[model samples]
Target: MAKKVAHADYHGPSGGWGSVRALGAILRREGNAGSTALALRRQNKHGGFMCVSCAWAKPSPPHVFEFCENGAKATAWDLTSERIDPAFLQRHSVTELEALPDHDLEQAGRLTEPMRWNPVTDRYEPVAWEEAFRHIGQELKALSPDSVVFYASGRPSNEAAYMYQLLARLYGTNNLPDSSNMCHESTSVALPKSLGVPVGTVTLEDFEKADCILIFGQNTASNSPRMLHQLDEAARRGVPIINFNPLRERGLERFINPQNPAQMVATGSKRIASEDHRLRAGGDMAAMVGICRLLLDWDEEARQRGEAPLLDWAFIRAHTHGFEAFADAVRRHDWAAIERRSGLTRGALEGVARHYAAARNTLGIYGMGLTQHRMGVETVQMLVSLLLLRGNIGRAGAGICPVRGHSNVQGQRAVWITEKPELVPLHRLGEMFGFDPPRKKGLDSVEAAGKVISGEVRAVFQLGGNLVRSLPERRLLEPAWRRLRMTVMVTTKLNRSHLVHGEIAYLLPCLSRIEIDRQASGPQTVSMEDSTSCIHASRGIREPASPHLRSEPAIIAGIAKAALPSNPRLDWNAWVGNYDLVRQAIAATYPEWYADYSRRMWEPGGFHRANPAREREWRTETGRANFVAPESLEADPDVRIADGEVLNLITVRSNDQFNTTIYGYDDRFRGIHGSRDVVMMNPEDMQRLGLQATDRVTLIAAVQDGVHRDVQDLQVVPFELPAGCAAGYYPECNPLLPLWHHAKESHVPAAKSIPVRVVRQA
Candidate 1:
């Protein structure tokens, strides 16, 4: 039967899912509204003003049309049509709300008023602002502050994040677990150890200057389509792009820049991928090892011929240490060993090696597609290792770009998250507040989830992010959520994260970034740090969605006031009244680019934070750069492909979707619309099972480890794929992602490498 469509009331799949992030994909998806504003602000402020949504940025003055279909859709998702109000929740029971699908829950709208779960009614009821504030304060005051879990999302602005950390520390706990813990914790944890910078070294400008771009594990065309235009420009200038991923995304295949009327009015646009490779999902480390092996061999051959070697030997001697140890480790693995595991031919590896050997400036760009596996950290380490192999870290056009997911996610970490004692930010937090902070290392996302599961953590306060869907194990996570004494969500929009209320829950509505602030400060502009470590001001160009809505900062201050009424830990009202004071506080603590942040913000293009690498200064302990080889290649974990299972399922995002948010299902990129239950699989796998494309099949995720996960009535379709592999979209398949199945060092949930068996259950 054909579905009936009502005018202005048509319904289908809401295409909202941000980056895979740590939960789904790496920094490889659409940007949330906050992320969009942050990216736009940076682009309007600087040279590499790239779109965070889909890699659409113009080095030569970026424009709105520079963004792609997904980018626009991403923008729309941020400026959503839904509204979350007190009356909405008043009408629905807590259990009933929980029963709604993830998409339905989010589509209901932006949060309008502060709400608390009424124990008697078993439903969330609107609570007065004063009552809400008092309830929060009483709860925090009752518990040992150290036991309270303070969680922040990457989506939160730097100012909000700094304040969040400040409030937590002043209250006396270092449990500052946030979104970074989920996605790039390894990047955060590894890079400081690897190259002394936990963030991407390459700015948006680097994309235009690089001679060769090797994008591994990143599906930029779909994930960040805006980036494809840059690659298109690089291709026009005769630069090479070596793309590596499991699936051949259409976005990477080609791009038609609408901004160019010649191309837009005519047929197709510019091409993106000159050469692409699809490695086994978990085999990036091994694939990279092969490339390194090839480089070393080429270097030796050049030396034998009395020719200068390909490696920047001078740079290594003056800047890097531990090369000898790293070289020794690379020597242990032979070419064949590298190929067998990586599923790449020896020539494919050499082709990449040859390009690296010749290109003066090579940017190794990657997304979460690389980091969400058992070897994700190793995969990222391998990419960084590639840059280090040839002195690419601190160069103008050469570096490892992790392509951060959230807008202010990098910004949040800038002043607040991963607090370092050496930095003045932490010092000022202590000095200004007159409070002693806990010096212990705080729990990360995975560890926090583990803490919640183990019943060590009691309460959870999510600043702005979907905590439940964002975590690894849904079954474990759902129950763990219920165990909490309280779960407070401060969000502008409604999402499944708010629905998964704890036994005691509070929902607070906050101002959207697009809104104007008419506070006592007269008018205020918010500052955010972009991927390249540049701090710029973000002023809302549009009116606020609601007259009653408060800014996120104001909402957070309200929470802080609720948590601590006596002495009011950090002078919440004073700081929230004017964000500049927060900036001055930031400047007082971290005197780098923010020395006179307010004055500097008035200037065009904002200020770039000081990175020693940018100045050709080495911050390593040896006073030199170091390149260490990975101890081992990343092997595909043992997900037994027994007789019953059809193929190993890999979870992916459709072009229309961001991470977990549903705008309305229309994946314009893939030409798939209306539904998301369809699967893309290898023809061989389906043929063996006597099933064709679109055949209904139930994926029984009996992952041999005794963990059970399943996807029922899945419609499988034949697509281009390696014999053993298959692909399906996410959240539908999110359950298949086992909690224990994560990168060894980085507890980033292995959404890519699911050790599951897929089958046709009639």
Candidate 2:
């Protein structure tokens, strides 16, 4: 047996938000100048245009000295002076590494070699690339493609994701689940049904000219620091920016623009929000419905007063249908009912209404905070409705902005992986990969994870992802991974997913986007679309850390060769060697924007795909933007509302994090120092429980099944959030979210809303 060390949570020496700042300073202390420069250069060259972390950033790119405290940490940690080689693996067994903390293992360094888990030594051992490929092919060949699930992380390049999806479908399965499936699957699934497209309706420029901005679920200050500039610009223009969330986030509350030298010197910053509304989590859809109800009610009152109506009759008549039913639903629900559900008084709700009538143009921006609940799909629809009432969607400076979470999550989804589409624009995907398209819908992320855990899934080939930690329900996925016949990961760094040892597990290190790719043909450039739907070319700026790292495209090509050695259906080498050929295939099939991908991506800002829907040109069967009115604006399971317990436990990301991966321990804006153990609870809840700011508590998730999934202790911090609501760190609080507890339509975990009971620790 091996002795283990307790996991350290860095609570500042004084205990509180001060510790977070020192943690940030300590993180910068680690020498990372070289990698930092390279990473910064990538952002400048490629990253300068749009953030790779969250949404389509509208502000000008940050300069060398312009990094936010959190962005500085995200970049710094990625460029750290550490390396994980086979030697590290030799020193530690698989069991031992699995026991190590996620941050501790990553802090060791970037993985430097291809590794395989050895049963004999119970450790991971290095193997030649050829041997690993051969073993992978054999295992894949033995299983049916339908039985295998391919989980993709957003970190992979567009070309890599394109190739990975192609490989999975060609190998005979469309079990393609990704990070988007967990976060924005609601937007992906519901947007097309309502808006005739799966992406956001607004472009980046919309943020600049909008008279009013209603931001929901997203903590812009923490997640996409660059976007704060847009809010600052909006404020300067006197635009009323309204924010809604359970916790009163520091970012949305007030942002001190680090870019403003005068402000920084004065120790004062720009205010992003003119007014903020802290609505209970899972109450967003209802609050939005209240706004709609107010609009409709005002229109009715105007008719009685012989005054002008609140709705844009011209736009509504020309662009939409179901207005009758939509208006009917809004009319049925009044201010009192909506106010009761939303936790905002009728007066406050009217304030939101007054802002709507006052602003000629408005922009609505949302994040997973809105899309990760049971009403995720409905919430997205309500926002669409909110925009449509004033006729915001088709116009400039007013539209719906679904802030995508990963650097290129939205971009990748555009390039390939069209799961639920009528036509699928598959000509390009088909001709490029040289395989007949599998005319079938496949399992989504939650569905795939459920299938895997239930022994229905025999194998999994995740392209650049950490599923065990990346997804919800560790209790489910951990055991499911062990039962896998084979598990293969194509990655740039070693992570928790690498340790989910199967009957046969292999970790194939791949090239990062920042590294040079030298193939037999020549150096290659891959294109990725930004959240705003602008595409750009990304070529490596630095050499690979080691010669062993293969590009994701090359790995997919190799896997294709091994999987279909004698298949006449595919020419794996042709697509792999000359990426241009793949681009040509894309052009031949999907000519919307990628008709000449090489030429288009070469342009400075890349090409914007034609958005016919931008002009209210719906591509749906009806050829008009349609309305989807839910029977009830209310959704989500009945959260256990104890006398002193919290109802909605929404999960959120900090500045030092991107989704599941932790970059560091500092969340500067949130006043969270050194550790992620603190949970943000309403001050009223604290009083009810006799808790203070730093009171530690044991949180047992109120699951319906009576199963204490991943119940753990979390420190309680009294925040200015609304009563009955609380916020906690993700992947830590992820266990509290059940695998089965996802959105009704999207199947994404309801991380935004969970029932919880807290007790002061003994």
Candidate 3:
């Protein structure tokens, strides 16, 4: 069916009556108006489940209604009365269901029972939980441990994530490919290299104290709606908020607090961005270079005038190293190249740089827009260097805030869920788990895809996430998945990934965070860390969508016991019975921040994980923060475009979307209503290419690879974006990104900056 497109006036401000109306529509559609409302009120509250929508840290002593519009949608979708039982599966064959859209597949509702793919009939039939585990166990026991890859998403709780990784390690493989590899792995890789820590140093409290907040490549109002409240507060306080992005997002321009009745009914909304810089796609590095170059000049000029300099010289000299080399490289950068690459006038960039120089305390916040590019790591490091110039790292209301995507992605890594064995304190983990940890580095998501294609990987297991939709190069990934001997998905709802099965496949239904998990130890609560390092408890209040569903930890335990029956060290039943035992194991493995995990969790707002970088303590090899010099500003050397009508493409999430999970076919904030198959382009670029708004066009990738990749019949909409830059929804456009195209250091797929040519459909 053709996806409908209805254009609505762009949502004036992020929130207000519009949000209230949307929330109502979602609840009514779910047919559980009363239950959904109660669930939403409980979200992010004391003794309530953390929102599974976005990882925005809940405010300390959260508000009465702490949820956002998107959170309400997710809650309604999760707590829907609809259920996918054996009868439903029997009616819909795997081949038939595979033809449905992602939204339809999930809207078919939550999976209620364990199902095994019947190759003979090409259907999924109900299988006993034990039999499903036995099949997975049989496959793993037959294949070499290294041949099995375990994929995880960021949505799972800390307890579930820890158990998932521990099971993989105990099963003798480091092949843990996670969602971070596709999203914020660049932040993880770059921060540690520059600031001596993988995580951001800033806390939510910093939002209040910051004199200025510089936002890069993130639409906070839509992605993290609760953050709009913070942004609104910052704007009302007259703080200078600067934004850098290719497209002018409404969320960055202004926001209306739905919680504030006076503001909602009185003044409409508060102006957000003091200045918005429209940098070209893949131009963040050049822009950062330009800002730093101007800052360096300002510092020199201030010194010549016998005035206090903008640079924090004392902090630089005492706590940082290699400043001269980095500053020299900044000086050597050609202004003409920076202007051309960044698509910004030198005067405009310098104007913003001066504002940055004036702020005593600044907060640098960024998202996937900056991290999903070719030089993502370099761009992140440049951001760190810019902050370090003013000693922003170790002060109140000042630090790098790489706003994370998933609920507990940071906590997942906090408990060590990475593929790199060296990053883990192996001896300590081994001591806790009573086994020798794997020494070899494992494949990330992209690499794992390649291995699957090459027949090197025989078995696949996913904890939580839509691997096929989330990963790049779906054309190649489809065939690779089919080649696997066995595939297992532990998921709560139906998704496209469930249809892409191997010869032997199992779908194990797991409980969602909004659903109660009554294990042998009674009702249990799972812990999750937010974007900021604050850790808190999440206890589901509502009953499960289905009685057949099991807790994620319990499911993992069952699989682990079945897979490694002879491994006497693991007491799966004992650990799964009581979640506190799981937290105890986590604390024992990493004694640093998690010491007394259970005791400290009861603290008012949950405790902040210890971060030495917050105190100006550089834990780098040289015991000081290092400033690395960037050789150039170009992000993608592999991109080649024809002269006629090629443009840089960035696959973005619509306001109605979250990490490959589509809530609806509407992006109200962007004026795109009831449509997911639309391309956003600058009007000038559309004119140059002989295209008009609503014109049906085919987007073909401009790469040398022989494999063809194109998404056909996309509605073209002229938007206020930089010329030569086009934006489209992700997963739909993910095919344009090849498997080999990724960031240099972090190996994250370059989904944001793809080069493509436009062809008008006849």
lDDT per prediction? 0.69, 0.73, 0.87
Query: Which residue pairs in model 2 clash with each other?
Result: 19-673, 19-674, 20-673, 20-674, 43-48, 52-407, 256-269, 428-589
lDDT of 3 by residue, 1-762 (tens): 346566655857778877888888878877778978977888988788888888887887777789988888889988887889999999989999999899888887889999999998889999999988887887888889899998888888999988988889888888988888998999989988888889899888999999989989898877888888787888899999999889878866877788888887795788899899899888888998999999999889989999999899999999999999999999998999999988898999888887888888999999988888888898899899999999999999999999888777888888778899878878987876678889999888888988887889898888888988888888888888887899899998889888998999999999999888998989999999988899999999988888899999989988888888555666889888899999998888887889999988767678889898998888888899989797888877676544658899988887777788888888888888877898899989888888988788899988877989998889888788998889999888988888888998888999888889999998
Candidate 3 ranges with C-alpha deviation above 4 Å: 8-11, 640-642
Q: How close is every model to the real structure, measured as TM-score? A: 0.90, 0.93, 0.98
Best by TM-score: 3
Error of 2 at 523 (Å): 2.4
The residue-by-residue lDDT of candidate 1 on 358-441, one tens digit each, is: 899999888777777776776787787778778787878888777666656777778776533443255566676676666766
Stretches of candidate 2 above 4 Å error? 1-30, 38-52, 58-72, 418-423, 426-434, 567-570, 640-646
Q: What's the lDDT for residue 741 in model 1?
A: 75
lDDT of 2 by residue, 1-762 (tens): 111112223322121233235334636654566556445545625333233345443323334443444544545555556777888888888888888777676677667778888889887788898788877888888888789887777777677777777777777776777788888889887778777888887766777678999998888766766667677878888899988877766656665555466765565655678878877777787788888888888878998999988888898899887888987877677666677677787777789989988888898888887888887898898888888888888888888888877777776677676455343565555665566767677778888888888899888888866788867778777887898888898876678888875888888888766667787688887777767777777777666778888888888888777776566755667777778877776666677667878787766556677777787788766777777674665657556565556557878887667777677676655666667876787777788778876666777777768667645556777676778888888877877778888888988788888888887766
Error of 2 at 145 (Å): 0.8
Model 1 ranges off by over 4 Å: 1-60, 64-68, 78-82, 419-425, 565-569, 635-648, 702-706
Task: Please tell me which model should have the higher lDDT, number 2 or number 3.
Answer: 3
